[model samples]
Target: MAGFDIGEKWPFALAAILMGATFFIHLVAGGRQAVRPLLADSGTVPLDARMTLYYAWHVVSIWLAFATLIFFLAAFRPEFEAIAWANGVMAAAFGILAVVVTVLKRLPAAMLPQWVLFLPVAGLAIWGAIR
Candidate 1:
């Protein structure tokens, strides 16, 4: 906590909090709402497909957790800024993809509101990086 100056790097701190919250929501709520159902489909969904999707889900979980830690570290250590930028770009990409998919698939925006969660985290990370 010695070099953790929230006043100077509040954006990164805020980004970390948001990312952390998002990670937990994805892990817990998504597991219950999405993964559980996917796993429960014994006959309809193929085992290989289900397992592949499950692997991808955990990959995302790991990425979110890593980014959260990197953002927290970047809030205190200037050296981690590059990593923050990388994570920010990835976050922005995720947000943009959500919007693109919603529009292209003719799905309701509210149905795939990932952009609402990710874009702000991207914005905060970029803001903190350049601050």
Candidate 2:
């Protein structure tokens, strides 16, 4: 926090914080409301503790890793432009693909809102990387 001036990079920092919060919210609340029910009714062994653990672990790990990485990039924006660009491109592509998939699948209304959350993250990352 010493070398990083929050005022100078508030947009990226705000974006990072929003992204982190969104990831956390999705991992917990959204997962419960959406993923848990799907997983439960998938005809898989609902009582399989190991399967549940494995699934939770996979989801949490990816969510935390990506969110943490974005925070790191926000904290060190100038030094991490290449990393930012790489992540930005990936995030942007994923967002676009998710939108397309959602439309093609005619996913639930809730899904669109969830996917829309990533656009700001992608925008901020690309903005920070280029600037």
Candidate 3:
């Protein structure tokens, strides 16, 4: 944490930006993708809004948690590196889980990019936290 607050520590800032971007893209785009099909035939049939809502909540909750870790890393406000490490581990775990869930849910191919993008974000966050 010696250079945590300095501009010289670009990695932490980059990791935060990447992770935040990942969360933003996934939250907005993924939500649209999940909800589209449900709303497609809403006029003709009883759309299962529950499924779309479920995905939205799940993605938001997970990515937001991960985003918090990235933000913490960027801000470098933690008094203890251990706390950052803990959040980093959680972020990485959820990053992996996001990929798995994306495939398991059989979502559109477009949604896969965000999960794939998250891998690097997760790696950077962990690296920043530990380094």
What local distance difference test score does each model get? 0.91, 0.65, 0.61
TM-scores of the models, in the given order? Answer: 0.93, 0.68, 0.59
In candidate 1, position 115 carries an lDDT of 90
What would the per-residue lDDT of candidate 3 be over residues 1-131, giving only the tens digit for each residue?
Answer: 66457354445566667766766765677568765555565555444565667666686658566665645555565453455455556667766777787789987755556556556656665676666
Candidates 1 and 2 compared by lDDT, better number: 1
Model 2, 1-131: lDDT tens digits are 56556556565665677677766776788668756666666555455764776578567548646754665576565665566556656667767878888889999756656456567777876776555
Can you rank all candidates by lDDT, best first? 1, 2, 3
Candidate 1 regions off by >4 Å?
1-4
Error of 2 at 84 (Å): 2.5
* Candidate 1 vs candidate 3, TM-score winner: 1
Candidate 2, which segments miss by more than 4 Å at Cα?
A: 1-4, 38-64
List candidate 3 stretches off by more than 4 Å.
1-4, 39-74, 80-83, 98-111
